[model samples]
Target chain A: MAVLTDEQTMLRDMAREWAGNESPVGAWRKVRDAGEAAGFDAAAFGTMAEMGWTGIIIPEAQGGSDFGWLSLGLVIEELGKTMTASPLAASAAAASAILLGGSDEQKMAYLPRIASGELVATLAVDEGPRHDPANTAASVSDGKLSGTKAFVAEGDSAGLFVVAATDGLYLVEAGEGVSVSRRHAVDFRSHAEIVFDGARAAKLAEGGTGLLDAVLDRAAVLASAEMLGMAGQSFDTTLAYLKQRVQFGQVLATFQALQHRMATLFSEIELMRSAVEAGLTAIDRGGDTRAAASLAKAKANEVGHLMSRELIQLHGGIGMTDEYDAGFYLKRMRVLEQMWGNAAYHRERFARLSGF
Target chain B: MATLADPVAETAVDAFRDEVRAFLAANFPPSLKGKDNAMSAVEGPTAETPEQAAWRKAMGAKGWGVPTWPSAYGGGGLSREQAKILAEEMARAGAWNPIGGMGVMMFGPTLLEYGSEEQKLEHIPAIARGEVRWCQGYSEPNAGSDLANLQCFAEDRGDHYVVNGQKTWTSGGQWADKCFCLVRTDKNQKQGGITFLLIDMDSPGVEVKPIRMISGMSPFCETFFTDVKVPKTNRVGEEGQGWTIGKRLLQHERTNLSGGGSAFRMAGPSLADMAKHYAGVDGEGRIADAELRARIAKWEMDWRVFQLTALRVLAESKAVGGVSEVSSILKTVGTKLGQERAELIIEIRGMQGLGWEGEGYGEDELHSVRAWLFGKATTIYGGSTEVQNNVIAKRILGMLDHQ
Candidate 1:
């Protein structure tokens, strides 16, 4: 297991306090209104970097923590609870993949920059709105690349892009070979569609199917961990609302029907929590992670999606309105549900990896 | 908990296994394999014979009545792991428990935990020798689910308490020699004034009326206790401690009833075995129906998960001992899987499964149908599915119903 030591716990606690104190409830609304290209606080990012939070997943040789995936997952979970939009998860997860499968030269070239937050990168692997990496329509040739990558996360802002081509993985500059077009996701996050036409690129690794699969598994697990944080936030928000929202001469929490629903939802989240921990620990322990990652992602997709839907329904008409923050969680969950893979994809993958 | 097998303890376990296996080989008649009906040795149709009684007496005299209890208390005194190994070896040897009436399954563990020294000395020996049978009297007609509201009253009469109410759902009461019951000794408190009392089944004014179930067999009965005098010394724990004792006793009862042994020792052809037997080998030696095969594959995956979970709990309990609520979760998931597996087993049988009679269909097929019918009780008994879910809510999630 990648141990989250006392120091990591303190870092998370500080972030949680900031989320409660500094971050306003309508922070995202401010971003939407101001039309500032999506961003987080520079001072807070500096504080995190000084505390070495930015290097929480990087190797020691690259001047980072190297505590591994579980610790990084915890950071993501805490950050997600605040709905703080940042490139931490994307950068760390993508950087970990580079460390795992990229050659020594690749690591020496990019790891330090990513660790210092000087450059942010994200994995662009969704081929045609589906989660199948093998169905890549993008191809590479002679250090030049030509293909379009759909659903590029934070594409408008990211400095570097890790693109999966038919041959293997290729690294391309954000604007040189790639033309970024913004699209409004359900969560209202900055997503993009990128078209690459015979643009200059560098191939990172070739014939690294096994290594790439392992990295993809780690990415899948980290994505689930982030979703778990969203689910927790949704559950707590809905529960607090139920306790305060009075109806029929008593609080809505008093209704057995609602209590039962919340109880079932709580059980689902707890099970998902354990599943996520198990998956992360499997990667850290160097055990069979193919099955564990699929189980975690499947559980997160199913339970996270369910919790989002329930949170909205429980809040009644106020939940459907854009003015309410519950709608944001619901939207975020929808985006996360389709991020790495949805429930059905993970279930089928779990069965296949388990030798079923 | 990491448990490297102890070489010394492993030797002891293996020796005990060999002894039990040899005895079973000599004693268990060979005609009972794969017979689900024969699994319940207590309910078998074979008449009691002198040889069978002699064999039982011989086995009982060795203090192996339950094999897991302490020798000082008339038990086998083996370690918990050894006891489990003994049970497994005996099951593998095809020899049913020679002494597994209500006494061993329900009362033995409770008596070990809560019974007084004198009570243990007097009762454990006779119980170990299979000389006495015990039946539970906790569930009353008016208190099935809301058990704490039982109205069975016991009036103090100087030295003895006169129990004057009734208990329903007393399993195996018709064959039991004694009944352990709960009665209210004080009326002022809701659940605080109860007392746990043991009384002879043949006492005056005692009546047992069997309640027939859907299976056509009366596994339980309604036991009436009108003016039945139980000695004050026979009361377990304190006068007001009955509720606590009863709850703890029920935990053990549920755990033992739904433990891991049954999951591993399910009868007749397994679902996979049957699918293979009936469907025959495909072009690549696979099952024919892809959907059915996929469902079975999922079930198998879940089954392995449950087994690993069960083993984890078991190892934890062995290392640091206590009655864990984790058992309730196992019971909930395990019983659901068991019921689903039974349904799948029947579906795999197909046309020949329709034959309930006739010698054409093998004995295993008939047993499979009976097992399918019998498996329905796995969820209903040992606290119903609804009860289990509530336990999961209250105990695990800490989510009590809002007042």
Candidate 2:
């Protein structure tokens, strides 16, 4: 493991403790059972905000800790380990979009509220079932926004939506002329399909073609980090089960075939970890964030899906049931895989970024 | 937790980088640029051209060949940061580390760790100076993966040991000046009875028979030792401790085989360029075939991720102060990536990739075919992929040994 700074270690320990104690997998199960009305635990998210996590990526002057992208990734990774359903990743990502393209006045107006957990926000980038960032049918003209955004994570809860339009990113409030209807996802998390008809919208930035791409890249890196945590947790759980569960009078792990499969998953998870860390490091160091983010997301998507499926397959019949947490991971991975950009999407993006 | 790089140290490193850049510009030969300087290919005697020999001599004399080794042992005696600077500078100049072989990669590091004062003085300097070549004698007909089952016997005489055995997959054995061998001194114990010995290849009974590979190259040999007499003083550690020493040496070998030291250089034209050349491109400059483009893109992304993982491992190793099972992980991942690249190259070339020797095929096509064949052996050698997976499962994942 890379040496973590004192602050980073402290942050990780706290996040881990909180995830285990306040919001374990059972907590998520309960939230899932409560349906879309309960959404995520607002109190737990407020606790995270109190811990200065939501402000990790925002500038200090904007009421944030300014701990950098890696710090934010560490928190998200920990939250993901327990399948904790919250708006942390979504809010932080929306904040990043604003920081990237929002004017100073805009930042002053929204960032403090986001940093304090007074507002929940998310980036509505996906317009259809497929992950296409450039083909946004949403548009803003005469200070009004129109078009529908599908698969908007935390959209049901988000007071603010950073909508990707043809021109650029536009800020739309959750009030009049805008509707957010809850969309049931396989993950049982509260995602929403949001439609805006002549909603009063303000542009975050003007004539910056790469602004939304930058925001999406940042979001992708964080999403990759979260997926890495999810994959790691699934692998660990399956490995533990393998050691305990016996078949044919021997522990499941004693079987070489199963051992090799678990080993492969371990290797892939480590690869995703390294890629996610590299992406976070790139963002922190202000390097080639685009390629790094795409690489991380691509690897995470591939590994996450593989690990999720393998977890269920290795666990056998119980894994297929909705009662088992393994299904939750599979469902979560299914959503995250298609979020931001799937493997295919990022692969092509990576190719284009490489000047192919 | 470790702190970030010190500002003063960073400044010193920057200055060192400048110095290294200047030295490389002056000393690195332009003719050697883009030339293959793989240690495995050039280690043995008579393998190097006069140009390679000159480059090796220059690097060895300057002590930059083994930059991190002690100066008393004919090495640069540089710090890790300085060594990294040297490597970066050499890479920037397209200069290869001329002094590399089994000696530098496996034997040298192991000897430095376990060798006695006399052994260090005798062997370390020679290896540092790139004056002698060494080949490992570990695998046997019965001891491929189960290495401790080796039957190469060495009877301890008063002054010398009489060794009689055959070692298979002895890489570069034909030209190696010496052999770092494992011989079973006692047959009762599987591991504890083994001994590690250094033997002269010119010893009366030592013989090497080349093994023709699928690549149509004889890079390996079956080495026979028929009652060869090796001196008692040449033994590396305690007789029974050979297993430990051997494992340590394999660790070094695996690390070297993983391409950790020289990963920055692109071996040839990238997959994108190959695609553009052969598969053609669309108006948007994308590959004409969508599926091929997607596959190439996936491979390229994987390659980038592999490189990043390698860097992460390096950084983590520095902070943690030891290499974990990650060397095994790297070995598995690196070889697969290499093999995948070769596969992609062959796929991109189409019919030309199938050529062995023909008038129509270009040098790149022929080389790609050869590389593809050679790539198959990469997973088999230096611990096969399955063995590595087992190592990872047992060591890193805390799985019980199935065997």
> Which candidate comes out best when scored by TM-score?
2
Q: Model 2: how far is A125 from its true place, Å?
A: 3.1
Q: For residues B1-403, could you state the per-residue lDDT of candidate 2 as single tens digits?
A: 1123677777777888887877777677798796645535623345677887887887888789999999888889998778977887887788988787889889998999999989999998888888998999999999998899999999989888999989999989998899999999989999999989999999999999999888887788999999899999999999888999999999788777785653554567878888888999999988888898888888887777778778777777878777755545777888888888898888888997889997999987987788789779989988899988888777777888553
Write one digit per residue (lDDT tens) for candidate 1, span B1-403. 1144777766766677788677667766655443323354224334545655655676677677678788887788767676677667766766555666667777888888999999999898788877787889988878877888898999999898888988987877887888888889889997898888888999898999988765556777899988888889989999989998888888778767666555565544455556767766466555666566667666765565556456645655655566444555677667888888877877887877655667889777776676667678778777886777676656654554666
Best by lDDT: 2
Write one digit per residue (lDDT tens) for candidate 1, span A1-356: 12246776676677677666665456656665555444455455556666676787788898788877777777777767777777777777678667766778888888888888777788877757767877887887788888888887777777777888887777777766678887777666767788888877777663356655776778888888888888998998888888788887787876767766876676567557767776777788874578778777877887898999998999999999988888778888888878778777776666555433
Q: Could you tell me which residue pairs clash in candidate 1?
A: none
Give the Å shift of residue B352 in candidate 1.
4.9
Give candidate 2 misplaced runs (Cα > 4 Å). A1-3, B1-55, B81-95
* Cand. 2 Cα-lDDT: 0.86
The residue-by-residue lDDT of candidate 2 on A119-214, one tens digit each, is 998998888988788788999889999999998989889999999888889999899979988888888877789999999998987426677777
